[model samples]
Target: MIYYFSGTGNSLHVARQFADRLCEQLSPIVNPVLTHDKSIGLVFPVYSWGIPSVVDNFIRRFFQSAEVRSETPPAYVYALMTCGDDVGYADRVLDNALLSASGRKFDAVFSVQMPNTYVCLPGFDVDSDELCKAKLNRVQARVSEIAELVAARRKDVRRLKRGIFPFAKTYVVRPLFNRFLVTDKYFHVDASKCVSCGRCRKSCPVGNILLIPTTGGQGAEVKEVPKWMSHCSGCLACYHSCPHHAINFGNMTAAKGQYSIMKQLHG
Candidate 1:
């Protein structure tokens, strides 16, 4: 089985491609409750040079559970991370997390470069059409190579080159990102642009967004607005999936454009 966590369809696109090539089933990491024993593969996007908090929590909980502890580890295990540039020591972090939880390590780990989706931050923006297409083509070729190796059950461990900067970025910067940067408090919908469409709430993987009716004057027609809960994963799904570009993360995301792999592929 291939378990995946995707915010704006990058990782999900990769996971589906892998699943098709390997003849495997695809499972979402959201609220994962595994009971069967089979070869396992994980596909997720890199967040802050590390795994997403939701993926980390899910791995910890799933592996440490009584159900998993009662059985032997899978025969083969692999992980593939999608990132805009590179995943600095993310593989190491994921291996350590798995070892800490289930006392097992991934047999293979790899990365694929995808268009950057973390647009709320300054100096980051969605790729242009030419760049995005180039990236998609390159990643598709890379995924094919990876799928062949995985189908053969071969071991391929790709790690970041040993360096102080990469180490500090992954170990020190990642923790700070998870602790301070991952929150839903700043997310709000533009009332004028919003169409009462539930796309934001539907796209959120963790169900952190709610459509609440506005308290207008008496006999006024009510419209629902998105209210973000406290349990956001900072995945940017609600922001990128909005049809009218209605969702905003403070002032930063309003000017930045939206992107989704599915939309790009279909369009």
Candidate 2:
């Protein structure tokens, strides 16, 4: 089985390609969630140099549960992750999770670079179409190499040691990061350009942003909206999916470009 978690489509796209290569069942960890203890593979994006909190919690619970024991344990497993930068100990996070659960080890691990769309965070930049295409090609090559290694039973794996930063970020830096940095970058509704159509609010997956009545309440509402940041996945789905293009990622992101992987696998 292949287990995947994705806020945007980057990791999902990779997982889908991996499933196609292996001819295995693909299961999502979120959005119609499922549980699996059988021989498995994990695919996701590296968030803050480690697994996302939701994914970590899922593994912690999966191993601690009694139902997982009756199934065939994973004799061979692999981990694949995509990141905007070098993956620092992200594979170790997954390795440790599996190790704690059943002493199972990863047969192979891989990381690839995808376009960074999480404009909600500081220093995050949107990739141009040209850059995205080039990186996607590189990632596809690496992924294909990983698939070959999996088929060959090459057990060249590394231990995850960069736990200090991940732990500190997950426990300490994350709270402040969410509280301070998560606003005004994910999606911004342009009041002057917006027609109060509620297109952006409806398009938001997390519903953190909504349309509210203006002070005068003339047509509908212009700018009064909730600023909840905890629920955001930084996918930019709201920004791209909006019909009016009124939703943006602020001025710095106004000129920023975007890209996506349409083909399941690249040749």
Top candidate when judged by TM-score against the true structure: 1
Instruction: Assess each prediction's global lDDT (C-alpha) against the native.
Output: 0.84, 0.63
Model 1 over residues 1-267: C-alpha lDDT tens digits? Answer: 888999888899899988998888888899664746567889999988889888888778877887666665455778989988778888888988899998888888888888889887789889987777888888778889898888888865663323356778798988988887799988888776788989999999889988998845777667898999899989999999899998888888878978988767767
The 10-residue segment of model 2 with minimum total lDDT is: 258-267
- CA RMSD per model (angstroms): 2.3, 5.1
Model 2, 65-169: lDDT tens digits are 666645664346677877776566667676778678756656777886887665644566667666777777776667677777766656866423243465565
Off by over 4 Å in 1: 33-35, 70-74, 159-164, 215-221
Query: How big is the RMSD of model 2?
Result: 5.1
Pairs that collide, model 1: none
